[model samples]
Target chain A: MSEQPTHHGDRPGSPPDGRPDGRPDSRAGGSSAEQPAVTASPSRPATSYRTLRLGAGPEWSSGQLALGAVSTGGAALFLVALYFAAGGFDLIWWLLVLVPVLTLSMAGSGMSLGFWALMLYGWFLLTDSGSFTWWSLPAAAGLLVSHAATALSASMPPAGQLASAAVHRWGRLIGIAFSAAAVVCCAAAAIHGRSLGLGPAAYVIGLVGLAAGVWLVRTNPPSQPH
Target chain B: MVSQRRRTTTERSLGDWHPTAAHARAVILASVCGVAAVLGRRPDLLVIAAPLAVAAGWGHLARPRAAVTGRAALGDATLREGGVTTLVVHADPPVRQADGVVTLASTAWVERKPASGIARLDDDGVAVLGLRSLRWGRHRVGTLSLTLTSAWGAFRVGPTDLPDLDICALPLPSAFDTSAPTPHPRGIVGQNRSSHPGSGTEFNTIRRFHPGDRLRRIHWPVSLRTGDLHVTSTFSDEDAHVFLLVDAYSDLGPREGIDGRPTSLDVTVRAAGAISEHFLRANDRLSLRTVGAADVAPIGVGSGNHHLRRVLDTLASIAPATERRDEGEHAIRGVDPMALCLVLSPLIEPTMVALAHTLASRGLTVIVVDTFPEHLVANPANVHESLAWRIRLLSRAAQVHSLTSRGVPVVPWRGPGSLDHVLRDIARRASAPRMSRR
Candidate 1:
């Protein structure tokens, strides 16, 4: 909780050391031997700065750092790939992926970034081919739209509304739909396959997504913070 | 009064120091880079350039003539802890932009809240920001740094200082005190010998004098039965006036201590504020004293809203001494005799104990409200000044007991419901009764 305006570093006043963060002087607030009962916040801290720091105390966990690294790394790597390939060089492409990658990169604690990453990569797969096959074009567009919708938990059209939906079940349903579509697309490619480079790499990554869907159903991390 | 007026001047004011011209140049360069990126179809260049542009634009927006006829308007100059306050920014020939930092000269905690509004030169050139809430005492919102620029971040000029802004934040009534002991003595004659008046305490009812009764207990009721005079004897509930002294030495604790940076002074301040309010509510005039240098007169003999305000302001501004081994010697050196002097402190020295005991011997009531300093524990391995700490605490505790044995009921103030009741009930039953909360 927050405290009153009068700030001493400790309950009794402050530390003898100039280090504001150091331990208090001897006999600071009779606070030894027992953890004081959590004092209720007198009031929300004078809400000044928009951002807050959850100090570098024990409260900061390694998991958070791990999440940030994973997110920023993923975005930077994919962005580099797209930049190096440098297709039509459309500025609009920046706008397309900007919201997802940037938002994901900035606030690293969420599944929202993962969903966007999936959609961006799906679009990248189709666009790089430079050939608009009837199946491929629709599949790419649907892939982006459905993935983004699932991420945002949105209902797009008149047919999309389904009341009484459970949050986890709804996510699983969407995953199954994507899995079906992916399996069909892969099967179609095999039927008239272009036996070429990086094709094997695409198949492997595709199987990974399919395997992840099953794992996600088994281990459900809550969408909200504990 | 005119002679008393100190000419307010700032030799190192924001007005005198404008940011170097180089800060503005950075903005121009960043903007040029933005244009280059757009022309060259380089999206990556644009990303790197935008933040730079914003930073540069910020400088440009901030730069302006530092000069202004600044008049600061504030909501309620006095504030209690956690009470909301507002500061209105106004300038003549209007500053193109209004922004500055608020520094509290005499407080443990205070903050300048975010504010936004438009200041049109053609219109009312005013901006308002909420100070929201503050901790305690009169504080000067001295020379705020202001940088003026157009809203667009196009052309920043120079930095100016907001002038003539000072405020007083009153101490708030605190509800947290978790350090009182229980099952206090009852039917007791407290340290203060002089009782206010009538009581139904330990003293028993008078009995009619019998023929063989002791001459000391010959009641008038019995005398009337036999048409003879008689003497009555019984104890009177004699309670005393308690003076709660708080050691306001600096270096007591952190500004924001383990408890949300609540300084040691903050705790002492809160304790003083709460106890004063409590005593005042109990129909007693409380005398507040802060030890160390810059000593102020103990809050005079008084009880009312005005008295509380005075105590709060005094407590709010109290700072710990920068020196070592000091107590309330200067503040209460020759103070009025206290019935019950409730001293709230860590008992940091033998002097504090000597002071309490000396007061108690004079038949002035003294109750030591210990501000527990033992909470400042940490590993000695990494600490530099680890030696000579533990020895100090033991000597101080001994000092407190010395006074307690002399009849001053030195009680450690623990907080919360039942214990507080016991302390209050015991005090009221004795002398230091508190006003019941409505």
Candidate 2:
């Protein structure tokens, strides 16, 4: 059997000779009486950017950075197409270019909704005032990709290195979202093919859409803590 | 006492599902926008609402219905300092599209991997966090909080803080060994040779064979020379009693955790563990007593490999602080008179110093092992503080000088061979003739 002795008395800051061990010494000196060997931290990958700045922890991996670049670049390309479609680039419109870049900081935040809303409003204004071209379809696809990329980046913590499974998952979702957009585009093409569509039948379609939306909301259950 | 046993993990259901902000946004945005686009006869507007509609529908159709319960556990309940362990958390009835995350709270002397201490749950809703202990003693591995967001971010189960779990991190004993013999050996079973002649491996002398002597004991060469049978006699192996008095009053130095340098308390605990291991491995009876630290439980003396484990466990339970009412009497009471007493401390407190004096005055073989860390004196960051320490240390030096004058050997604890020279010196002194004053 092993022995465990009863707790002994040693007050903090007291002198070891008279009082318990807790009292601080009357004379000056650090509390610790000895120095020990320092241990090295876990090593990082050779390509890590932690070395660039002192006191920095793990940062975005090369894969994450690349994904961000591609997503933002895709958004930029769509913005350029919209610029030409709207007849010219307005200075105010140029601010919208920051949307993709802002996604980096806005990761894991609700601000992505506002950014996407603003981008959607921009396209709405352009198409409502200018000619409605099929170009908007590709523009929607780009925006969707950017949104998914931001969400994917935010899914894990900042210090975490990129996991390929997450990237692939988000990519698949983006594809699905784009495919849905294509179906809407096909419906629009069909609408353009007809001329007498503003009848009671149109009102019936609108009512059905409203009812469908309500049913969807009712079927989904709210999340609650256990 | 609870820390000595491994805790079995228990879990409760995360509860019924509830809608989150993401769900509300998707549903309202899709419904209103899609309806307005249709009424306005704007195909471009419909295109804008297409993805939102899909998101809303997907969220509703795939909402998780099964209840989830999460369980967290440590890979090992006990670990040596600088040893690593896995902290795993798993959710039952895993939600396929759920985004689960587990975070470990920052703890003293423990280093967590990813620095952020966050890990994503896998497809099975399980996550593993790495924990490495930098110092000895009992400590909570930080708060293990869990959160799970269901498909489309529509619903959530929790961002709940789980019950705190504790780990007993044993001190990694400093490397130490000695070929020198102990000064006193009392028990029958041990490796050390005793003074008396008996059945053993070390040869003593040869004598005429007796009726009780076994045939194997006969020395052929001696028997042949004398024309008579002679038996070989050998010294007996015996075990010694070692009593360790540990001072746990002050914890000094910056606690940078496992990745940084050890503090004063770290040095003390590790040294105590090393000494216990050394003596116990020799099959010697060992006992431990701690002064200060109210939380530590009392342990009794014993020997063997199992006893060594108990010693390490007791060391892990140390929390630095002197009891408010104790005068250091009970710590020294009932100690064996023939036992070799080892006082492990930084000598920072008067109580431990007094205890050493009391043990020495009792005429027991007591040796004081200094466990103060060196960093305090080497790095003089603040001039005034350094000067103050210098003054206190000088006073401490006087106390040390007094101990030496009374014939108690004080030795600083270095990793290996730290006690070899002092133990040998004590052995020599014990054998020397001395006069007793009545």
Q: What is the CAPRI rating of model 1's predicted complex?
A: incorrect
Candidate 2 chain B weakest ten by summed lDDT? B1-10
Tell me how each candidate scores on DockQ against the true complex.
0.02, 0.13
Off by over 4 Å in 1: A1-226, B1-68, B93-108, B115-123, B132-143, B147-158, B176-240, B257-261, B322-330, B333-338, B378-392, B416-438
Q: Could you estimate the TM-score for every candidate?
A: 0.45, 0.85
Model 1, position B5, has a per-residue lDDT of 26
What total of clashing residue pairs does each candidate reach?
Answer: 68, 48
Supply the global lDDT for candidate 2. Answer: 0.68
lDDT by residue (tens digit), candidate 2, B50-152? 7767766776777788888888877666766665566778888788977787767788867665444667788878887766666777778787777776666
Fnat for each predicted structure, in order: 0.00, 0.18
Off by over 4 Å in 2: A1-78, A99-110, A129-131, A153-162, A196-198, A218-226, B1-12, B256-259, B380-387, B436-438
Candidate 2 falls in which docking quality class? Answer: incorrect
Model 2 has a DockQ score of 0.13
Q: All models: lDDT? A: 0.42, 0.68
